[model samples]
Target: MKARAVARVLGKHVVMIVLMMFWLSVLVFCLSRMAPGDPLQSFYGDAVQSMSTGELEAARHRLGLDAPLWVQYEKWLSGVAQGDFGMSLKYKRPALEVAGPLIGNTLILGGAAYALVFALAIGMALICVRYEDSWIDRTLCAAGTVAFYTPAFWLGTMLVLVFSVNLHWLPGSGAYRPGMAGDVADRMRHLVLPLVVMVASHVWYYACMIRNRLLDEVRRDYVLLARSKGLGRRRVLMRHCLRNVLPGIVSLMAISVPHVLSGTYVAETVFNYPGIGLLSVSSAKYHDYNMLMLMVMLAGFLVIVSSILAQAVNEIIDSRMKGAERGGV
Candidate 1:
């Protein structure tokens, strides 16, 4: 019976993801087709301008762009169903092939930043909770608000100018120094500025949420009881309040995936980092339909999956949610 319930839950989530992806694909396809730009420019570069009308038609036919919009969508959908994403018009390569390494780079950058942002947020929240209404908490709150509102591009540019251009302390762009690709330390040095921008832009938002939650937890009856039992303030906060609040924190992190991912993309573009974020910008600018379609689909899928997984985790962690799910089932 338990196994059956788990299977049912899994099946429901799979169906939800499939439906979401289908609609997302439809939306992306229609929008990309309707957007202004000559895809031929992406494919043929400056030569597209020199092509005669007849030659241009021939080129379009060769690339299957001469087909009607619905017909093209049908062809593209069928190809996607079979795990073929088609060729990238700009690179003249298989879309996945071109994006594969970049995806790994993005995962590395994004994954690290995601983990660090949460860690720092939680740590800062703890410090604020410890200090409560003291000057430290007030100072952090002010700094965080300013950092949260700072434009990521402007922050990135300033960091580059100061650290890379003036101090010569860190390399501003790219995933690694060209020949030092195998060195983890070299890669980390390149990661520093982008990571700083991502962390600075995101850490405070979550920190504030955590601080509020922790403060709320501190006032609960159980905390008062714990304090009455001669438990130290730090012990009660850590052992009781923090533990109780962790499940909500998990849910918050799951909800934050899309937000953090968007910040990652912005950081990537600013740094010229060879990641899916940079690829996304270039693909959109060049009207590389196949590449754009793949990136959009990948992003949408991740967002949907993360939300589903967060709900599942919530169900597992909170008995109230589990009971609710079972009753609904």
Candidate 2:
């Protein structure tokens, strides 16, 4: 029975991932076709504002832009299945080539930002729970609430002003220091401001969620029972309350990863970072439909994977809780 349940859950997860990928593929394709820009004209918009009838028709035929929507989508799907999302007319290169590096950049930024935020949040939550209603707890709560409402773009501007413009501690607003070195230190320096902005945006949000959860758990029956047996406050909170609140936090982190990844678009473009969000915006403005589709697929994939992780964490939590209940532990 256990094996069957596991198999069933895995099967459902796989099916859901496939469905998400398919839906995103179709949605991007259909919407790209629905866009008002003439792909053929936009393709040559720089070269000619006005074209003879024969030239216009030839360009349309070559690019197949005048085809029926369904036919165009079908052709696009066929190319996608073969791992060729067509070429970017503007860039004169494969879309995957353009998307690959940008995705790499995004993952680096997202990973650093989330790691710092999540680690600090858990620690802050523990501190808040340990102090309960003390002055420190109250202060953290007030500060976290304010930070939660703070905008990333504004935060980026402030960081630039204080650290870069005023103090000259870091570069003002761009990804890399121009023409210095291509080494790790150079990359780290470039990443600092954007990463700090993202971390600031996320830490308060996570700390608030975790602190609330831990506070709620610490007041529950299990925690009180643990304390009644003479367990120290640290032991009871860490071994019992924190454990119970952890499942929820783990699930939240899974959801937040996708949110941070997609929501970084504005931040990336604002900061002039060479990440997927900015790249997607550039591709989109230049009518690089292939690259646009790639970004859509990448975001869809991240969401689907996060959903699976959340589901798996929930399963483990429920199983453990049930075991503890049966044992009266």
- Top candidate (TM-score): 1
lDDT of 1 by residue, 240-299 (tens): 889989989999999899999999899999999999889999999999999999999989
lDDT scores in order: 0.94, 0.80
- Per-model TM-score versus the true fold: 0.96, 0.89
Residue pairs in steric clash, candidate 2?
A: none
RMSD per model, one decimal: 2.7, 2.6
- Candidate 2 Cα misplacement greater than 4 A, ranges: 1-9, 40-42, 177-182, 225-231, 327-329
Error of 1 at 2 (Å): 1.8
RMSD of 1: 2.7
Q: Give candidate 1 misplaced runs (Cα > 4 Å).
A: 318-329
User: What are the per-residue Cα lDDT tens digits for candidate 2 across 194-301?
Assistant: 877777667878888898898888888977887888889888888888877878888899878776785567668768888888878876777677777887787788
